[model samples]
Target: EKTETNILKGIERMRRFAERFALAAAYPIAMEIIEALQRAAPVDKIEPAGSLRRMRDTIGDLDILVTSKKAE
Candidate 1:
């Protein structure tokens, strides 16, 4: 029970931090970034995953999956 409480407290702290600094991007911005990446690369598949994929209200960071024929 103590561990669970601690975890919950930690999550609340993180949420406050995110809110305080506005350290998250809106969905549209995330989408734009993904689109830019796709356009820049020879992408066969490009998708946003993680919190973005889950459609969170605010995204801390972007996680993109891209598949391309070009090797780099």
Candidate 2:
């Protein structure tokens, strides 16, 4: 039982670490995507939302808002 408990705890810790790493890794990619979108579209304003906006250590997904004169 003790061994099982230890293994479970280790797994949980690893999962949390992976989540944080993934988020950290995604920041650059998200920024690139946002930049590309701005360049491709006629955007006046672009802002990060959700976890990225909050500047959290870990993010599950990216949310962005864009405003453009071309948008209807």
Candidate 3:
């Protein structure tokens, strides 16, 4: 039935959303990663964006922007 198919589709969408967010790390963990990056190299600018920048309790993934003359 069309209704059943719609229900299944909704369930699938929720499952994908949960899977995407379930892999999040704590805010502290994300900070540790940022610190490590700072120590690893000297960039003109490096900062956390997205949820991490908002200081969310959980971070799905790190979104960093780095500027430097060296590509390496």
Candidate 4:
């Protein structure tokens, strides 16, 4: 029983880790693209942070602007 619990815990941990890794790979370049799009535009309603999670009902991709506090 203890071995099964440990294995399940490890599998759950891997799932969480994989999610984070996928998001990390996607959000960096996505944010940069969103930033560039914002800079080139003349709109005032959307701010830097608001650029992400915009148009929730839109059919296309989410052009997000993500900010991280981690040190590289």
Q: Which candidate is the best by lDDT?
A: 2
lDDT of 1: 0.75
**What C-alpha lDDT values do all the predictions have?**
0.75, 0.84, 0.71, 0.51
Instruction: Give a tens-digit lDDT track for model 2, residues 5-57.
Output: 99999999888776454667778988998999988988998888988888887
lDDT of 1 by residue, 8-70 (tens): 999998876664323254666767888898778788898888777877665667778888888
Error in Å for residue 36 of model 3: 0.7
Which structure is stronger by lDDT: 1 or 4? 1
Give the 10-residue window scoring lowest on summed lDDT in candidate 1: 17-26
Better of 3 and 4 by TM-score: 3
Poorly placed runs, candidate 1 (over 4 Å): 1-25
Arranged by lDDT, best first = 2, 1, 3, 4
Query: Scored by Cα lDDT, where does model 3 land?
Result: 0.71
> What are the per-residue Cα lDDT tens digits for candidate 4 across 27-59?
566667767756766544433333234422212
User: What is the TM-score ranking, best to worst?
Assistant: 2, 1, 3, 4
lDDT of 4: 0.51
- TM-scores of the candidates are 0.61, 0.68, 0.54, 0.40
Model 4, poorest ten-residue lDDT window?
A: 51-60
What lDDT, from 0 to 1, does candidate 2 have?
Answer: 0.84
Candidate achieving higher TM-score, 1 or 2:
2
Residue pairs with backbone atoms closer than 3 Å in model 1 (clashes):
none
